[model samples]
Target: MMRLVASDIDGTILGHDGRISARTVRAFQACADAGVEVVFVTGRPPRWLYPLREQLGHSGTVICSNGAVLWDLAEDRLLSARAIGLEAVLEARRLIKQLCPDALFAAETVAGFHLEPGFIENPTSELLAEFTPAPLHETLTAEDAVVKFLAVTHSGTPDAFLAQVQPVVAHLVETTHSAPRTALLEMSAPGVNKAVTLAAYAASLGIEAADVVAFGDMPNDIEMLRWAGHGYAMASGHPEALTAAGYQAPHFDDDGVAQVIEARLAEEKLGA
Candidate 1:
């Protein structure tokens, strides 16, 4: 029997309009009521999760920052974090700069998002209000724990950019991107990705990968998808995710994740 349901938030469950469908919400609550653990695993920073607190309606654990941080949603507290050391961050930056001098940098920490000037253009008023603009090196001190590092460039498509940088930085950090067309790359500490953290978390609960059902729609979700026993890729998901997952679900816009969850619950009920 499945004991855990791990899902990616953005393209897997969350709609383009930034809302979770009623069907999806009910499916998640049903999992909880059935004594199954539902985990929202995403590349989002901890600060961006508050808006989702009410939407999800349960104070469960969120594996954010591509598995760099574990957040307790109910208490609005950080449970644990796997941060990139300052030297590693600087080294990776140096390596990437050598490959793409036009690359802009940003860092996410437990405190908030910090970016260098011009890292993002036409910043929304909300972003301008929330994000601190300062030189990344100056803003991130040796004492601060960096959760994730971001690099963006207007030079190439997101895939091409990742291809160019992955080889250069592979020895230094784990690199991936969620947005298919956006020329951005997200990096965490070496060997730190969704699967590694998710496995550890599940083990703590005495749950094995074979007892978990995972869903995702992006390259960032590949590791976790492959790690879970039953992994479903959204029909509209990136090519990499489709190839990584063993099964495919309907499109996210069509409530794909919810459809699968409801079907599984029905199967379980019938078997019982």
Candidate 2:
């Protein structure tokens, strides 16, 4: 039996309007009523998760920054945070500057976002928390270790930018993105992807991968979908996610996540 549901935030649950639908909320509430845990696994930062906690009725865990941080939503406290050391940050910054000179950068710490003024926000993207803007040098050397680093370029396609940056920094960090079309690149600590983190958390609860179902719609979600026992990609998801997942759901705007969850709940009810 599927005991857990791990889902991505932006493209999987949040609609193009940038809000979670009532149908999605009801589906999750149903999961909770059934004693099935629903966890959010996403590339979003901790600061972006509080609103979701309210939507999900303040239940479950949230793996944010592509798995670099885990928040126990029920308790309203942090569970764990994985950070990239300054050395790695310095190395990554060096490579990013070398490969994409015009790239803008930001870092998501456990506290909040620290960004340079150059990093533009997608109009459709979630409104960011108050940010600390610093010079490139200070931004790279910020006191606290960062959970994830972000890079944006106006020059080329995201895939092309990633192709140029990956080989240089792969050894130092894990690389992926929730928005590939925007030429955004997200770097997390080495070995910290949604799959590894979610699997670890599930194992802690005596649940195995086979007992979990995950959903996603971006390249950042690739490892997560691959790691779950049953993974569903949104029909309107990125092409790479479609290739990575075994099943597909409807679009986020159409309440795809709720549809799938309701179906699974029906099956469980019949089985019972």
Candidate 3:
């Protein structure tokens, strides 16, 4: 029986209007009512998770920044943070500049976002409402630790960008795309991903990989999906996620996650 539900936020659960539907909300409530731990695992930063916290009634752990931080949403406190070392951050910035000169960059510092003018926010992001813009040079030289770095392109696809930078920096840092269509590429420290943090959280709760069910629609979710025993890729999911998941669910706008969650709840009720 599944004991945990790890879900990606932007595409896996939220509706097109960037809010939770009643159906999805009910699914989460059912999970809680059934004593199953619910985790929002995503590439979204902590600031962006506030609305979600309110939607879920602020009662669970959120693995944010693609696994760089674990937040106790109910208490509205940060439990732990894993930042990329200064040396690695500098090295990755240097390599990206040399290979992709025109790429715009942003870093998620412990406090908040330090972004350049060229960087664009996802239409669904709430963090930008209070973010501060800094020069790329100034941002990269900050004394604060960086949780994640984003490379955004004014032109070109994320796949092309990923291919161009993988060989040069993959060994030095971890890289993946959160948004499938945009040229937004996300980077975390070596060996960091949703899977790493989620697995650790599960172990702490005495839940194994076989007892977790995860959902996603982007490349960043690929690792987490693969790590879960029953990974469901959205019908409109990215190619990488589709390849990584063991099964397929309906589309996000169609309440695909709710469909799956409600089904699981029913099975539990029936002892199936």
Candidate 4:
């Protein structure tokens, strides 16, 4: 039986418009009541999470920035966060400039995210409205440390950019596509990802990934799902993520997260 449940936000937990359904919210509350950990693991920053953290109740810690940052939402503190090194940020800036010359690029920092001109002009429908955009150097600089680079490019460039950036900066990143046409490449300490972050979090509590059941619907969530003992891919998940999971949950629009969580909770009760 699963004791922990980690889910992606954009296309897994959140409805397409970015809000969790009333049904999902109720399910989460029950998960908390049952002492099951419902960790929200995503590629977003803390500020983005600020609005939703209060609703999570007794859910587990947030695994943010593709796992570069582990935020203890209840405690209002950062339990762990691995920042991208300065030089790598610079190199990444240059790489984005070269590959997606017209792409929108920015760096994510503890303070907030900074954007380059025209970088966010074409965000995914869901993201276009939520994020605040600002000039990169104006908001963040070499002096202001960043956790990762969030790049927005036409669908055509993601594969090309990865091919080019991986060989040189592969050691610095774990790139995952969020929007069908965009990539959110996070740079952290070598070998960091949602999986590694959750592993560390679990170890801190004497828990194991095998006791976890993760659900997701995007590329970044693949590793998190694979790391869990019982991995569930949302029925509407991207192809790669779908292929990585052990089971399928309903799509986000249909309350997939809750359905999966409910089933697992029942399984746990039977086992107990």
Which candidate has the highest lDDT of all? Answer: 1
Task: Return the clash pairs for model 1, or none.
Answer: none
lDDT of 2 at 63: 90
Tell me, by TM-score, which candidate is best: 1
Would you list the rank order by TM-score, best first? 1, 3, 2, 4
Q: Name the candidate, 1 or 2, with the larger TM-score value.
A: 1
lDDT of 4 by residue, 83-156 (tens): 77767776666776676676567777776666665665566644546556666655665676577677665556
Screening candidate 4 with a backbone cut-off below 3 angstroms (N, C-alpha, C), the clashing residue pairs are: 104-119
lDDT of candidates 1 onward, in order? 0.90, 0.84, 0.85, 0.72
Clashes of each: 0, 0, 0, 1
Runs with alpha carbons beyond 4 Å of true place in candidate 1: none
Candidate 2 wrong stretches, greater than 4 Å: 121-129, 139-143
> Against the true structure, candidate 1 has what lDDT?
0.90
Residue-level error in angstroms, candidate 4, position 69: 0.9
Candidate 2 lDDT by residue in tens digits, 142-244 = 5776999888998788788788898899999998877746898999999999999999999999999988999999988888888888899999998999999
lDDT of 1 by residue, 1-272 (tens): 88999999898988778899999999998999999998889999877786468788768898999999999988889999999998888888989989999999998888778888888887775776777688887888988889999999977888888999999988878999998778999999998999888999999999999999999999999999999999999999999999999989899888999999999999999999
Task: Put the candidates in lDDT order, highest first.
Answer: 1, 3, 2, 4
Error of 1 at 174 (Å): 0.5
